[model samples]
Target: MTTIKNSPRNLAVTVLERINRQGAYSNLELNQVLKRHQLTVADKHLLTTLVYGTLQHQLSLEYWLQQFTRRKLDPWVKQLLLITLYQYHYLERVPAFAATNEAIEIAKWRGNAGIRKFVTGVLHAALKSGWPDFAAVSDPIQRISLTSSLPAWLVKQLAAEYDLATVAAIGQAINEPARLSIRVNRAKASLAQAQAQLAAEGVQTQPSHVAADGLIVQSGDLLGSQAFAQGIVTVQDESAMLAVESLAQVCDLSQATLVLDACSAPGGKTGQVAAALTKPASQVVALDIHDHKVKLIQKNMARLGLATRVSARQGDARQLAFLADGSLDAAVVDAPCSGLGLLRRKPEIRYQKTFRDSQRLHEIQLAILAAVAPKIKKGGIITYSTCTILKEENDQTVAAFLAAHPNFALEKTQTARALKADRAAKTLTILPSDYGSDGFFIATLKRVE
Candidate 1:
């Protein structure tokens, strides 16, 4: 039974408007709104497009509409017109007449009966006028920033941090819906075997750039699919799989190596770490700071058929007590971060992430590294990683840790070879452009006893 409580377009418009005006998180509000109604797959897609697309190119739509509307309409009426214009101008499939008609129908709810005619007129005018060329403005950056719907500060930040072209690439990338990638449950089958099973089930996969366990899906909900329920696959991001692969590269599993997945949560990487080891392989201990997430880790381990050797524990990374100093094989400290690198997957992050989160998380990241470093096996590897792109959470935090602990040494990444990096740096910070993946930082270290 479908669970559509309201019309997808109407629900999406209401949600988008409320999110803009009330400062609600789009995804959260969208999910809450969805829960109130049961929608079909097509409606689901439409609603997603209406919400994310409206949010993504809102400034461009508004700027173009402003050039056509004569009288100042109410905010709601203006938003309806903009929504209609977004479809009319940008979306090729939606016919101009249907968009204008639907928008006018929605405008009838407003107090003025005359609003319908005004909306119809403005939409047609904008459609015929065909968007503005704001590049001729005095300051082109502001024009680009608003037209691209990116925060101006972020535009300057990325342009300075990366290059002008890369910043533009990033701005374009964040607006696209994130591609789905699936993680293979190695305890049950190899990635090939999992792919074969999914193929027979009418789902296809491509080999991921990183992680022997990673697969870029062709189609289907990886979690809801049969392969997933049968413990054949897991849903994960390509970059996150890279973080796990980085840890696996450092492991020498011949001996009884104790691998620590510190700060593990939602356990995708934890499952990968456990699956990285072979039979009678090294013991992998996945630890999370919270008790509830321990179950999540355990569940993932079970799904991957790793429950026998991989251990999931509820413990804080700041003060881990179960392991001895310098007595482990390897440690994957996938630290908690501001998640700046993942803005593409979660479009709302551009607005949600603040500098304060970085300042606060820096302390927690440093503390976790210090506490977990002592637990690493002497001369064994410890890979510190984060899903964030900011230098403060990546290199700067790492610099502080290295200064504090002389025993730890910085290591390099061999995978980010194509990154046109000229400046001298000690850490392996993989830019999205480097591997055609999301930006990430992975620093491999070894404890010199």
Candidate 2:
């Protein structure tokens, strides 16, 4: 087998090219490339910064590139220019000359003499011309779209639903990198025990203000550490942890209970629900749509020492004929969504998602809720959640479900520490700026009949 090049710039370019040309996800593609190559900590940081920065500011970069290039360029050439422009404008520590020289060198390695000259000319032209004036854009939505590097459609949708200032804040927040957080496995260890163990291994951490069991990883290779290997901790966003915590708060998990995680994969929230149960007699059933995802849930449960408490099954959540009606004590429908709230972690989603996609997801979300509604026993709780802030997938979906199923009503009393609940509507909407977590929405409903 041939070796893969791992230089910071080369890796960034390779990752960007794949994402741009092949429609690969930025995070997944970057992780795969990082695992294949040996990179120092600093190089790893640089690679991550380059890849994410280039993607985050892609629209703005192209706007600037237009000022210099009279004609369209090759896909690889455009990506390389974006990477260099990202460093030039955003990363102050990187000298301008270094950024320009690196691009020319990479061009020489990957292109012909004509391409090399083209690359050099573009960089020199960009340096001489300076940045584009986004303020000149007349349309408010268009201005925000170009300045924030978000899609114009997303900007318009957000503007329609929120004030201009709030939309601007949302756009700014999503561009920043997500904070790293880990949930302490209460089953295997206490928060103190996990923190001390991580400290002993030279990992710095601070308690998360939002999640009761979360700790912000200040500095460390959390995944590479023994704490992770031994399952003392699992990387999870505080907002997601809050969703499970909300379900646990409203439901009686103190006795023998059956909780179904209808769309669990990678098992983060399922593990949270299982670990939160105070009674050993209670069990959590985790289901996913694919065999690979079911295996992933099983693997995660095993790692966290929860294999005995959480059972993994492969099946579509929209069809639950295998389960008996009114059999479960509680259920969580963390429905699949457009993932608008997770843009900080998954920047590529902004470009890929459309208004029509959200409409389709709203239907799927309601279908999964309807399928699981009958599985919940009388007075049992069903938690509806998504890693998206769009009302179409959150509030409107719940409203539609309640309209169709009159026996179930929103549980109004459930509350979480960092989540803001609309008591009148009985739903919690957690914006990214709200508590420094992903944009998430949760609602607890009761089968009152």
Candidate 3:
């Protein structure tokens, strides 16, 4: 018998219980557990699948559990049942008997015989009855919420912002697995050179329709490939790579052009800016609030051999006393947002965030823009961006900033022909359903004064 602590099913329960009860971020908690344990590749893959799959469909799993049992279940018991049900309904590769047996073993190890019997009965009953019809739910919003595993508030909010059809599409898209993408570093190699190098190293690639320098990974170990090891490419979503590309359209990257990455951390955008610089004198100042994250930016820069092009610092975005007024040629305000746009990558955010959180982030975003506004030279561009699709955090925040600062004006943003991005407004909002990339918003503001 596998030890309780070593069993993959048992570990999934522990991770899920922590996330459900303590509000832990699924990616962070899951990674932490994986690092602490010595597990085989197959075991790690199973653990990841169980954790993400269960969280992705939690609302529906709980809804199903409610149909079979009316009793208030313990947190662990509830989590165990949820993962078991996820395997039954979603994971067709797993035999039903194997899922049931593994779940019962985990229950017996974690609890007494009474609990074991209860879990066994619920699994048997659910197997016999099959999934409940969501059509029976009367409220359109509630039905969408349960079926999509989105919160009622989120479903309603999306519905208010978009039509029911669009909302339903977004709900369906975010539950799908996130794609793995990497940006080819043009400073070191062209897209073709990078692709050839990656292929020689056993990784396969396909061009991204959303970003010119982006590639959607098809197969093989990207992280272990020589192209990644030697910094010929770096992992970044196609949508995220667009923010810097949009900035490049309005701002010159010639020698001696100084830019500020106001909220850069782990240095993805900062690295992109560095790679786009035309001469050695062109540089980026990357700032983050935490010291460790500042070091992370520095580490990434050194890894990419772009250390000389970026100056990593720890500071708040709302304050700019260290820099003189109108000193920067351009700025990137990738403001900290509610992360509503990253639902496909971080499913737990749908349950963790609220509409009010976006409202509060709006205030902070405006302040950061205000601080960075004075730092940009006349006719300079400030590229504001976020990983959230909410208008309050995207367009509304930009509108509010422009209203408060008459000196600044919104500029039309253009992406590559391949992206075929929406041009209805100066700002661009890319939904998850648009191109299967992380949802993002980008707005360019020019300082005219």
lDDT tens per residue, model 2, 1-449: 21225578878999988988888999899999999888888989999999998888889998898888868778888888889988889999999998888888888888889999999998998898888889899999989999888899888888887667788888888888789999999988999999999999989999998888999999978889999998899999988887778877878665537899999998999998888777767789999999999999999999998898998999999999988999999888899999999988888878888999999999999999999999999989998999998889988999999999999998763544534444455688878767778998889899999
TM-score of each prediction:
0.86, 0.95, 0.98
RMSD of 3: 1.3
TM-score of 2: 0.95
Give lDDT per model, in order: 0.74, 0.87, 0.90
- The per-residue C-alpha lDDT of model 1 at residue 95 equals 82
Name the regions of candidate 2 deviating beyond 4 angstroms. 1-6, 278-280, 421-425
- Candidate 3 colliding pairs: none
User: Best lDDT goes to which candidate?
Assistant: 3
Candidate achieving higher lDDT, 1 or 2: 2
What RMSD does model 2 have?
Answer: 2.1
Best of the two (2, 3) by lDDT: 3
* lDDT tens readout by residue for model 1, 1-449: 43222666567678877776787878889889878777877878778788788777776776777688657766677667767777876779988787777676676654467777777777777777886887765564576576667666667766766666776676666666666777777768887788888988878789876555678887855666689887778888777776666655566544546788888888887777676676485678888878998998788777767787778888888888878877678888889997767766555566656777887999999999999888877777778889887777888898899999998888664342223346477577766554556678888787886
Model 1 spans with C-alpha error above 4 angstroms:
1-5, 21-25, 62-82, 110-125, 137-140, 253-256, 278-283, 416-426, 434-436
Model 2 CA lDDT for position 123: 92
- Alpha-carbon deviation at 291 in model 2, angstroms: 0.7
Q: Rate residue 23 of model 2 by lDDT.
A: 87
